[model samples]
Target: MKKKRSIISLCLSALFSLMLLFTSFVKPVNAAPTITLEQTFTATANPDVVGKWSEVERLRVNDTNITQELFITDNEHKTSTIVKGFGNDASPNSQLFLLHKFAGWNTATKPYPVLFVHGAGSDGDFAVDPERNGTTPGLAQSLAADGYAVFAITFAHPHGDNYIQREVLAAAIQRIKDITGKTKVDLIAHSKGNMSSRMYVSDVKKSWGTAFRNDVRRYIQLGAPNGGIDYTFRNTWAAWGIMATGAFGPVPYTYMTIYGWPTDTAYHSIYSAADGGGAYPGQAQMLARWDNVYDLDIFEQDWYTTYYGGWGYYSYSEGIDYAINQGGNLINTLKNTPVKSTVQLATLAGSENVINGVVMEDDGPSDGVVFIASATMTDPMISGGATLLEKKVLPINHVQLAYDPTALTWIKTQLSR
Candidate 1:
């Protein structure tokens, strides 16, 4: 009986080994790895970003077999060459500027192109490369990678004058329309750039004589001083503190600008020569125009009226009061402007401590330079003209507002919308 049992066990073991061998030779199929979606901002980045602002069919990034190449254009003009990439400032005409265009743009998926407008004393690169240290990828690069046609403009004079900035920006807008072959483009402006964009939107059809106004879809403003920054004239000590540190100095001039002045003095000197040798750009006499955009107080009142030999000068408050009275028309304009929902308008403002790390007014809170109240668009022309979509308040300083990750993420979400 024992011998018979051993034989049976041996036979069973051989049968199991044979079955294992047969299964191994047959080969098993491996399933494809689950594709992971990366979130560019808060949530995971979706390849099928449909029902967004894009007019074209949603894209499947992995479906395409053809490799996408990034192209930088260098279109030559009669005087200067309009090129792609950063650090180019060899334009023959001062007004003629070049914009950095990111290649590998998946227009099929993301159709509407984004045009970034930098703020006062700042250029296009300020949005893409806010730090100026060149260590991290700018917002432009990130947007481009996400499949949107990204373009950045560096004005000849970011802080020169509103009218001139508007003209240059209009030209840039037309150029963008021409290049992308899109009827409209989206604007993401910062600081003084917001002023230029607002002026452009308010008058692009009249000025450019194109459907440029209709072409604009989204007007996203970051740290926009739509009501004008009161701290410029309100807090003298803080203003001087920021000025002494050269906050509005050379690095910005050299970064994304083609015809920017190396120093404030240099620009002021040139302006003085041009202004019939009157005053520097800082003290450059502003024409009395009660607009929601400009610091109207500077023009409406006589700030230099109380200049004594030893008593010094003190008339900012008086000037402010007079300016307020003169700004009645502007106030009326802001309040009465009918809501024309052609372009979607969104504003992002920042507030916290001033540059000196001290909180002065408990009114609302400021992003050092411009107050939160001013940054968020409250004027009628803007809030009424365009469809007011989003008004977010970020906790950051003025200069750092553009570079903040939360602000950038919020911008991305708005663009998606």
Candidate 2:
């Protein structure tokens, strides 16, 4: 009996030894440190600047030192001007990219952190936390309330080059990973913001830019012009209205000749520059005509001349074709570049034509600014390991995709999955 017991005990000991050996071979997950928001705030350089970040405050969260507001300097472009309505500061300092982190990072319950990329003519603050007319919370706020880590980035120029913006995005993702101890993050981009996000994921880069490091787990684009957009060129009258309201940045073509205003040489006109370099390379990158699929808005003044390149009673346009050429015709490049198959992609398009109570783009199905076809296009990302998780069209407008309650709900659902 004693010999039999000894044999059983030896077998148990060997099994225990094998378990330890197996565990040693397995890698340990880098768990997040147990840090509370209060503990994090105690380490802040400027604790007084809570809620909104001042230019000087910095915070140390989870042993990662970060500024309350971070900046990305474009080493390539030494000078850049912010669009009129986006910001007033065009100083050398303002040319740097901007980043924002909403409160409640330490208390986040989500597995992955979310990074918000604002569209053209917008910033991090306005993109995620606009002053809404109703009680519905902004998209970032909603995500934060649900205990999700939320961060946002604003480009140096509202109309900055997409190549530079994509590089900046790579930096932002690395920074978020450093702060949260998460290797991968999810990107939420809107309109033109999708250009840089797609560029990063697709590994479409400039010589100096960083290639895709496979750091993004999921990408959600809202009202993106995936197939490209020619709204301004298709409806020439819209340019006059946009410039008059001072809403969007400079249009690709100058209309001062028609409006009797002095022509601003600094305007981002395709005619004045080669490859759309003088100003607003980002805007130039998002140019593609859908005239083959849909007709130009006939009601718009000089639609024929504006689209076909001619002098009309209302305006003189070099034509949509010329604008696309001068703009680098990046849509072709983007369409050819497939997103890495590993990342999951989803897109949302707004079908509503009214934005901020103004009627726009009534000619076909559009989010006032982006057509449904352009917004929902996923053909470019299918070839690679990238999977199209879903494509949804909501009843919101282009601007509302950032803050509307319905859109926010859909975004939350996607994030949950």
Candidate 3:
């Protein structure tokens, strides 16, 4: 009995020491970074005018940072009910596609509230702000006009290397809850948008508890790089190299990113649930009936990856994909994003490590900028929530999935649950 007591005391001491170490490491983790945007009041620049030129080279080469066109006075979150300049004027030739039923023509039935999410490196202007080279017939404005009260929020800033968009989205969700007082809301997100929603749901579940989960009912992932994408290649060799580069890209201090990649949790959970046996049975049901997109008509297993680069050395699928994803074609404003080949990576390793389908030239499946399998997530089941709500196959590419007609009906069906 004396010996047992001594052993228990030693164990207690060791446990206390470990707890102290853990708290020390955790101090920095809990604090999120705050970004502040500042612009000179006298200064004025128009992104529309500045964007007319790909002066990145000139700006960097000459160090000519003085702007003739700075954003014409900081437009502080323009929130108006009937935004004349912001909303689109229905054109004589404006054609709404594939909406003859459910959404279009039938004006009596209350059209479900639709949420529009922009991807990384983009602003809400892409959906609403016309002056920011913004698109007309924005999804939020149109859906709200049809019936549903819409919510639109952009990331605090334009771009980031990680999924910082999740926090902005979380704030948006909170704002949405405050306004509607509804039990559930519908969501549609594109690119990192899909993953951002996952992070919002997963993190809220883990950090805040399950109460807020009820506020968001259905999640629709449009043209999502759900699994980390491999921009290089899908082969085994290319994957290792991409991982080496991405890992070396930035030193991570937080587990906020799904794996190290921002948009990997849902994608990883989908694949893991599909393959992992009897591992958390709850997730198996949640992630069931998700979509994995593939353009089989174009190419097969290994060979399909090559087609993304296309036949030409100067193909749009090659170098320009990253360019479009990072920043749209500076020259051609109307370049339709045609992202193909949602190739699955071979395998995953490490605890937080996952195999994302993203790849680059001469590289394999990636993590956002890399391949799918290579990307990892913190808690996958929470990332995807109760459903993946995805888009795949014919008439579906990364860009087209954003407001795809098929995804609309499906989103409504899911939310009704």
TM-scores of all candidate predictions against the true structure = 0.59, 0.77, 0.39
Ranking by TM-score: 2, 1, 3
TM-score head-to-head 2 vs 3, winner: 2
**lDDT, candidate 2, residue 245?**
61
Q: Which stretches of candidate 3 lie over 4 Å from their true place?
A: 1-113, 128-136, 161-163, 204-214, 232-392, 404-417
Per-residue lDDT over 1-417 for candidate 1, one digit per residue giving the tens place of the 0 to 100 score: 999999999999999999999998985642211222211111123212211212111111121211221111111111121211112332222243435454543353587988888765455555555675656557776677677888776654434444445555666666667757888888988776775577666652222222234667888887776655443333333333333443431110101111332223222121233322211121122212222433323322122231110111322122332333332323223334433468788888877645445324233466765667666645565554577778888777777666667877888888898
lDDT of 3 by residue, 1-417 (tens): 999999999999999999999898873433322222211111024233222111101001111221111111111123221111112111101011000011221232343444566654344444444224334344544454446555544433222212234544544454444444554556666555555565454443223222234445555554444344433222323323323443211110111132345332111111122322111111111111101442222222233423233332111122223222332121121111111112111111112113244332223322223223322221243333244333223223343333445444444444444
For model 1, state the Cα shift of residue 199 in Å: 1.2
Candidate 1 — which residues are off by over 4 angstroms? 1-94, 106-108, 204-212, 238-340, 354-364, 382-385
User: What is each predicted model's overall lDDT from 0 to 1?
Assistant: 0.49, 0.69, 0.33
The reply for model 2, stretches above 4 Å from the true place, is: 1-88, 91-95, 132-136, 255-277, 357-359
The candidate scoring highest on lDDT is 2
| Residue 327, candidate 3: C-alpha displacement in angstroms | 20
User: In model 3, which range of ten residues has the least summed lDDT?
Assistant: 92-101
* lDDT of model 3, residue 118: 69
Question: For residues 209-281, what per-residue lDDT tens digits would candidate 2 score against the true structure?
Answer: 5668889999999999999988767756656665566545444455445367655423545343443224556
